[model samples]
Target: MEDSKKIIIVGAGLCGSLLALRLVQRGFKVELFEKRPDMRRKELDAGRSINLALSSRGLWALDRVGLKDRVLETCIPMKGRLVHPIDGDAFLSPYSGRADDHINSVSRPGLNALLLDVAELNDDIQIRFECSVQKVNLEQARVEGFDHKNNCSFSSQGAIVIGTDGAGSVVRRTLMARTPELLFNYSQDFLRHGYKELSILPDSNGGFKIAKNALHIWPRGHFMIIALPNLDASFTLTMFHPYESEIGFNNLKTKEQLKAFFEKYYADLLPYIPHYQEEYFSNPVGNLGTIKCYPWQAYGKCLIMGDASHAIVPFYGQGMNASFEDVREFDELMDVHGDDWDKLFTSFQDKRHKNTNAIADLAIDNFYEMRDRVDDIDFKEKRKLEMHLEQNYKEYYSKYSMVTFRPELPYEKAMILGRKQDEILLNMVRDKSQVVNVDRVLTKIKELHENMRNEI
Candidate 1:
């Protein structure tokens, strides 16, 4: 009976589906429940999925699941950020000095659907679409919810329950309900800024309106708009702005006002988006928030993973990548502890919580950097110095490179080293009176990493 017990996974989205496939591959039965209609058959969520930037960490996870090549076949690679400033000529900010170290732009719904499809191929995994799991009895490993179609409740018990239900997670809610007993620590920080999805249609010949290989950024001081390429030749644009400022989402209600605002800030962007007014009025503004919680595993029988355990803002483009990496990390723990859910869950969370928290903080830091710091004189010099170091020195990886390209390094360590490197580089770049030495800068970075202890 113990061996026959199934593993229940909540929310059959990206993380849940990939996780289910991995579980089944290890000869475990998985019941994956999703609340929404299967997107493979239905239309995607209207106007809000900013195209996901799939990088090394995410690719490593997919590779383990045997989907890396399949996924990559459909993804368009973005080499760097092309920053569009309001005052002058736009310039490209390379994500890395190396061309091979690029990020892929993948459709969120498309990727999720692919995961669901692959997950369903295995008989050991049973994915029920339109069924929502609202509560989990942590002690007993039981889940209770309904098939939203008929409004009928159902319950099941598993060897363990995994919550990958994302930001507003019901599994996480259950853990919160047991705060007194679990002493569960939790916090949510919502950004003052929010984002509304818009678009840049392809040219008449179905070609990309802008450079397809670059992630386009119209960076304003307080807010910014970002665009990523899609396979359809069109670009998925997200307008991230504050809710209460002069260029706030709440203030622009009419066409005239919206037109005036765009003309002032995004004049160059107008040619690509003739339907801006229509999309602006139609799409909803999504909130940007980070959710962090402690003791991701509950009672050795239930655990939370991905966005359910640690939700972060989309600024750093690591939300999905981090979630994918969660599966790889969990799988590694399973390799060591085989079939012992208790040890696996505890070990998994213990190693992961700090890393997740680091990325959350890093995402917030990137928000400000992208919004206000990208075009600064010192910042440009810093980037130029970093590019030179990266090209010549194989040992050197800028902060973004360390986090995005290095799958072997943990997020916590990457953040610690990256921040220190940034501070040093910034100081050096700011004081242009002295000549900069790439070898010396790399030596300092190496020393910092070597001297670092495991603070996480």
Candidate 2:
């Protein structure tokens, strides 16, 4: 590896660290920069996304780095959702018909620290924390920034620059600034709903307060609260609510209002999270938004990936998984277009843009389903029918299964076929009065898939 063949990555988060390791494995030198103090040296935010859902796509990326088994040792397996209704006992809805197909809850800081540790051990990788990137010359792969630690300015030009800097990326901003030449297109849609962090402490025995392996949900019509298990036996609870309504974040400003609202909607969950009132008032509310942009690559010398290019709502739990998949895909492309930075950047953008867009839309659609339809009669029936199909037929996968468990399938294709299958299944369950035939449903789906493939 030489300076002339170096790659500059702006953002030493999960995506950037993973990308640096993969690039170094392929014999390219890397210079990694981050705007914040290194978390391994200092403490991280206490109330931020402490844990994330890790599924097949993210696992595939981790396996490529030979860290999958090590990471899995730290995760808590979540088999399904335990739905708690307003007036009835709780019930479980399996994520998939297959027993082994499930997601894992892993701590965000734990995983990032591992990634940074491995990246630092590589001889060809150099990491610069506490450096803020101010400007980028896209065509020349140059970066100018301030070093917060040393109080100095520096600039460097590498062979290529990749932005894994997240939703408000400075590298992406440079692309926006040269919009006329790049013909860049961008759109951001913010949800009326926002989220605040809450928590459920472990029992006196230092065990879980509820079922340890399931994600629990309390889905009220307009808003909801969900919990994910942590390695410490406690659970991280998140309240997703609107901005200004009766039970919204703004209106429930006092302890009395919050306690009453919980009594009305989330009564069963209140006992487990006795400290909710304190956490709710102290934690900050975070926005839920989607950011989509075009021309991810400008002049083939600079490119944006991960949340920097396609930031999505978190309802689908695919935000981190999707970014991990980006590293996997980009690493594979180096084999096809070796040493041609322009061709490699072009292929990466063309391959990922549509699939990321599909996941973005799917995540948004899931927000409504999680809030309003998970406990509905028809939606329940639809899920039951889907489970039957998956159990009896190995080839069948629900939309959630396609997105979560099938790493070989592109998300755009999964979205298209899954949407069609959902429509047919819902119609059959609603419009018919007889027992559903699993064989007939499978046959119909295969026939329709063949027709769609031929048309494409």
Question: Candidate 1, residues 22-100: lDDT per residue as tens digits?
Answer: 9888888998889999888878666345578999999999999999999999999999999999999999999999878
Question: How does model 2 fare in lDDT?
Answer: 0.90
The local distance difference test score of model 1 is: 0.90
Tens digit of per-residue lDDT, candidate 2, span 1-456: 238679999999889999998888888899999999999898868635588899999999999989999999999999999898787788899999998989999998989999999888989998999999999988789999999999999888899999999999999999999999899999999999999888888899999989999988899988999999998888888889999889888899889888898888888887888888888888989999999999899877999999999999999999999999999999889889987988998888899999999999999999999889889988999899888888988778899999999989999988998899899888877776877776777788778777787532
In order of listing, the candidates' clash counts read 0, 0
TM-score for each of the candidates: 0.96, 0.97
Where model 1 places Cα greater than 4 Å from the true spot, the runs are 1-4, 47-50, 432-443, 446-450, 453-456
RMSD of 2: 1.7
- Please give the distance, in angstroms, between residue 180's alpha carbon in candidate 2 and its true position after superposition: 0.9
State the weakest 10-residue window (summed lDDT) of model 2. 447-456
The whole-model lDDT of each prediction reads: 0.90, 0.90
